[model samples]
Target: MATPNELTAMRRAIAISAQGLGTTSPNPPVGCVILDRDGVPVGEGYHLRKGDHHAEVNALTAAGERAEGGTAVVTLEPCNHHGRTPPCRQALIDAKVSRVLMAVMDPTSRGEGGAVVLEQAGIEIERGVLEQEALLVLGPWLHSLSTGRPHITWAYGVDTDEGHSNQALTELRRRHDLVIRRDGTIEEGVPGGHGADSFRVPLPALGDEPGKALHVLTESGARTVLIEGRSNEAARLLADAVDRVIIDVPGTRPSFSLTGPGAESAVPGGFCLSDVKPSGYRVRLTAERVTQDQ
Candidate 1:
């Protein structure tokens, strides 16, 4: 059983993990909170990027001597393997943390065995504390690990005539691992500071689909692909590889519809409205494809 303090710390760790979404591709976003023996949080940190200090290290550094005999609540299991940085399990052991609470297990073979290492150091281990909630932050990374492909999302804004652009969509682009555009299209550059790699592919040939382009991108290790545009190429992606759709409407409309021939067919079977909320002056709608297994 998880104590309320531990659960709250794990939630904080999950929120901090989101800070690395666009920046930490190929690596899962991880967060950590250090709590003193009194169960009061002493330090909090999140992994910023590859080759940087991990969340546990940063949190431990912030806690300093307070980390000894404290609890470490982390969004993902502490890494055990040596990568760009040293294994986090060793860091926790060195910090003298007495207990560890992790929301999710590390799915990768290299990332496994950390809990064992910690347990051997005489640290109390608690797994699956708020596991489902952690998935909301770790979902795309886990999906990429499981399928060997990046998760795909189609985003665009609808205008009265020419489709307008949404700032939220622009921010989302920064978080993706890759951005896809049609060949010959002039680069307008990313709206905000860009973090994702960009690729331009020729339109899918007749009798072919845009999924082939996605395959190439995913093969290059793109864990989150953003298809942003209103061109025929974007339309074809909607028909083929999109896993989710995000639309920004100018106002509150009783109903919504996509305009184009075969637009309805382009959506994956079993897609249903998953979210509708207000964004600034506009309304944002999200639809996700649901498989039977779900």
Candidate 2:
């Protein structure tokens, strides 16, 4: 059974995991909260990127001696393999943690699952405390793993200048693993500079297949790719490979229109509006591509 405090800690860990999106590509975002035996949180941490300390290690460090006999609530199972860092399972055992609560299993095969290791060390383990909510943080990486391609988000707007100035779009670009730009558009080099890699693809041919360039990016280990462009380019991507779309509508207008060559045909089969939220002064509408079966 999961205590309310444990569930709350798990949710907090899930939110912490999201802080690593766009930067943690190739590595799943993970978060951890250390709770004392009385169910009081002692420390919390999130995995920031590859080559950084795992969430468990950071939280344990913060908790220090208080972690002994405490409960660890983590968004994903502790990693048991050594990659850029040592295994996290051993860290928890070394910290003398008495119980573990995890939302999701580690899907990669590289490491032995941490649950088994922790159990062998005589720690109590509880799984799936808030699996669905945790998936919101892990979905993109899991999708990329299953499909061998990055999850694509197409971002564009009708008012080019205003769209480019939208804070949300700028933030999205900074966090994504890669940004796709039409050749010659970026005068100052990539928007994210060194934080993210950029790819410039030629303007779409009338019947060019979508995803060719993206496939190459995914092969290079990109898990989230953002398409930043004007309407025509967005239309081209939507007609082929974009998994999600975000359109920035300037002002508080109840509705906005996209006008340009192929703009009317941009949504491929169609799209399902997922959310409409405020982004600074602009309204950001998010939609997912509707597949044929749907």
Candidate 3:
């Protein structure tokens, strides 16, 4: 086990690695911590991109010979399988690492416990350090990996000074950047039903749909869709036809193929939507109820 200071250092290392996630695509985010002989941290790293140094390798390079007797703490297990780079398990062994601490186990079936790999190599291993915090950061990506889809996270900003209602408007507007805008034709999943201009509703009301159709309408090109946990029943109903799924809200994991009429959705109250500059074939939405939470 690492000392309190070493543990704190490990967390800082993970936070730095989290920033790399935004820029790294087609690869899962990872964080690593290298401790000195005395179990103090010497170096740290996170996965930053495809075809680049992995977190374990980067940390090993930074620690050099010092890694020979050091323990490595990581947010995710050292991957034993290969893809763009060599297996991280081999890198740690070559570095002469003596021990490993992992917060979360890799869910990939081929990624059988990194702790087991290190232990077989004669290094000490322990699992689950700061598990909850690590899971929260890793939740969406891990969920995506397990389900073969993209993770969806809703960002809501709100002002505390004013009442909750007024604050919601400001927050919704800022988070709209994460979504693409839809314009022109919006397709209904039902066959043989042509789209009608008169059928269009203000973008925000779409959120009231069983699946909160605002994001779904704009995501015209998405082959697989993951709806937030707060999405309406309409969105839930679309799940089976959609390529994949992700639920962001707490409680209840949804597993439906489609939404029936008059069903209720989980979209939060007070969300209103407006049109954005639609480019190409997409619908744009600006939320009326989002305030930046300071």
Candidate 4:
């Protein structure tokens, strides 16, 4: 249960967490808000990239002495074990934050999550505040962890006209962590607006089993990837690796993937089409990978 002021701060934390979307791969995007004893927000911060300060540390630093006896609201669990930086739980303890609230626990956390460590330090703890909202950004990272590979999406549309831009494809690229294409071309986003900057992500060729793509994604910390290519080029990329198929149909073409160069190379499980909607001059067809149970 959260009070009105705390809920408002949680919403702010969620919004700031999305700022780390493309850059915080290998590490989940996290946001934090520090509230003084009077329940007024004193400071806030979001994790910008890996090897940078965790959200709690940044917010605590911003709040300074105001953080003592205050409340800390985080979009994700504060980390307990340290890798590149010091554990965030320890930072909160050092700040003497009286209470901590988190949307969800880190699935990768070992043993008892960070909540236990905080409780042991005599700090009050609560979980699952605005959880579903947090999952909107955290899902891909969790999916990547569960699937053992990057949550890959194949984005393509038929545009006979050379100059036409695919709105759906652009939206997908903007939402994804990395944009990759045939011939191993890769792009990643930088510290700028959403439109500019991209990661030069790489993937193995079609038959390169147990290839470098997964290792790079996991070891390097990218959680999602978008592959933009034509039908034939899609065939050349790994068919089974894709988790979702995003088809873009221009005003001229009625649909896609039905009669294309890569039609023969379709994955064994095929795809389940959903959400047929229009975006500018194109109709977007979002398809989920049909698993055996479906």
Candidate 5:
């Protein structure tokens, strides 16, 4: 239970901790902040690598003797179980920290709640301060843990009409907002997972018209796309772009607003009749047609 002023300090601590997550394979991005008794920030930290000092420890060390009798604010609860190093809970206690404020609890099976461990040590502990923001920062890491492979969430505007195109991908790269996230694997529940495999950089930028030759090249790499039978030209363009294309053509006349990649429905004419859906409803060009166009 930190005071209002102390809570603000805690938020900043978590923000700082998030900065340390760079190129650290298989490790979540983490951040931490340390406050002297007066609630003045003396240090901050972010996780550097797999077996390095966690954000909390780095912040504490940055605080040095100032950490004694002071408070520690961290993004993730200080880990109470050991892996590459001893539990952070013991480190905080040994450092003589008088109070601890945490954002989110760790999800790893090896993770033991840090707040519980700290409270048992007789140190004051506060939990759930700015938890949502903390979780958002840790989303990639958590997703990797849960799905066994990289987590995929299509994003952007609030409508189904929005999609990637040759020019758009290029523009995104120029703007630098679009990033390809991949984690090889986390645990053995599945297989061949290593954790954050690699990131694809400089995704092709969108052209002036949004549809371009480069976008066609990118479509070749996609697993699937969401489409409605209404836009045949768009569908065919997309179909030629990706390895597999999923176009929605209603058997009878009923529509649903549910849209997004991988949404489940019992709708008929889904992935049915490559010829009709692709050339007629989705795309009109077959290999011969495309050859003629060439």
Candidate 6:
């Protein structure tokens, strides 16, 4: 069981992890909070990008001598293998932390598990502290790793502020690492952020389909995309790519698939309107693909 303070730290860690979303592609957005010997939060940090110190290192660096004999509460298990940076497990061991608390286990961990290494180093280990909350940020990257394609969401009429009133809009922006518009406009995910300049390569021509646009995003190591455009144009961008659909107003609109009529699909599973509710002056509809297990 996790203490109340630890649980709170885990939530804070999860929130910090979200800050790394768009920039930390090819790497999971991870966050860490360092608690001093008395369980007082001394420092907190998040992974900003690859080739940068991980969340643990950043937090540990901030914690300094206070980290010794303290606890490290991390959203994900610390990495045990050496990458661009040295192994994080070793960092924890070197910090001499008394205990390590984590939410999810790293499926990509190499060699001996970080937990095993930590335990061998005389540090206590706690797992699954707010795992589901941590998954909210990790899911997209893991989805891309498993499927070899980015998870796509098509949002209609929710791009502009005065257009729709729904909480999903905020959630969409927070989770999506990439944003695409059929009109060749780029959404920076954040207003006044880097926008299209974040992409490493030139974007495809306006006439090209979303597939070509996706290739450029894939190169940026983005694992999830949020799409915005008009009906048929947004539909054209969706076609075989979309994994989720968000409609601001209920209507009898045609499916976005390139195929005609009953053969409609955004992806293999096809999307089904999963939820509907009122939002301000309009009804919001959420459609998601039915996975194999579902």
**Against the unseen true structure, what C-alpha lDDT does each candidate score?**
0.75, 0.75, 0.54, 0.75, 0.53, 0.76
Look at candidate 4 and tell me the lDDT of residue 196.
19
| Model 2 worst lDDT run, 10 consecutive residues | 184-193
Q: Candidate 1: misplaced stretches above 4 Å?
A: 158-165, 181-212, 232-239, 250-269
Query: Backbone collision count in every prediction?
Result: 2, 0, 30, 9, 31, 0
**Alpha-carbon deviation at 244 in model 4, angstroms:** 2.7
Q: What pairs collide in candidate 1?
A: 22-175, 239-266
lDDT of 3 by residue, 151-236 (tens): 43332112111111223323322221123112222222222111222112123434444344534443332211222222234434
Q: Write the per-residue lDDT of candidate 5 for residues 52-127, one digit (tens) a residue.
A: 7888888888999998888888877788787777788888999898998887778763544777878988999888
Q: What is the lDDT of candidate 6?
A: 0.76
Residue-level lDDT for 120 in candidate 5: 85
Off by over 4 Å in 4: 158-171, 189-220, 232-236, 250-278, 290-294
lDDT for 253 in candidate 3 is: 31
Error of 3 at 127 (Å): 0.5
lDDT by residue (62-111, candidate 6, tens digit) is 99999999999999889999888898999999999999999989988988
Stronger candidate by lDDT (5 vs 6)? 6
Candidate 2 lands at a TM-score of 0.81
Tens digits of per-residue lDDT, candidate 4, 61-153, equal 999999999999999999988777899999999999999999978987755778899999999988999999988788778889888778887
Off by over 4 Å in 2: 159-164, 182-212, 232-239, 250-268, 291-294
Q: After superposition, how far is residue 173 of candidate 4 from its true place, in Å?
A: 3.5
Candidate 6: residue 83 Cα off by (Å): 2.4
Model 1: per-residue Cα lDDT over 1-294, one tens digit each: 789999899999999998888667667889999999999999999986667789999999999999899999999999988887899999999999999999999977363489988998899999999999999889889988886777877766664322335566557766776665543232222332223343232233322455565566655545777776545364474455577877666663577673654223333356777787787766667788786687
lDDT of 5 at 252: 24
lDDT of 2 by residue, 55-104 (tens): 99999999999999999999999998888789999999999999999999
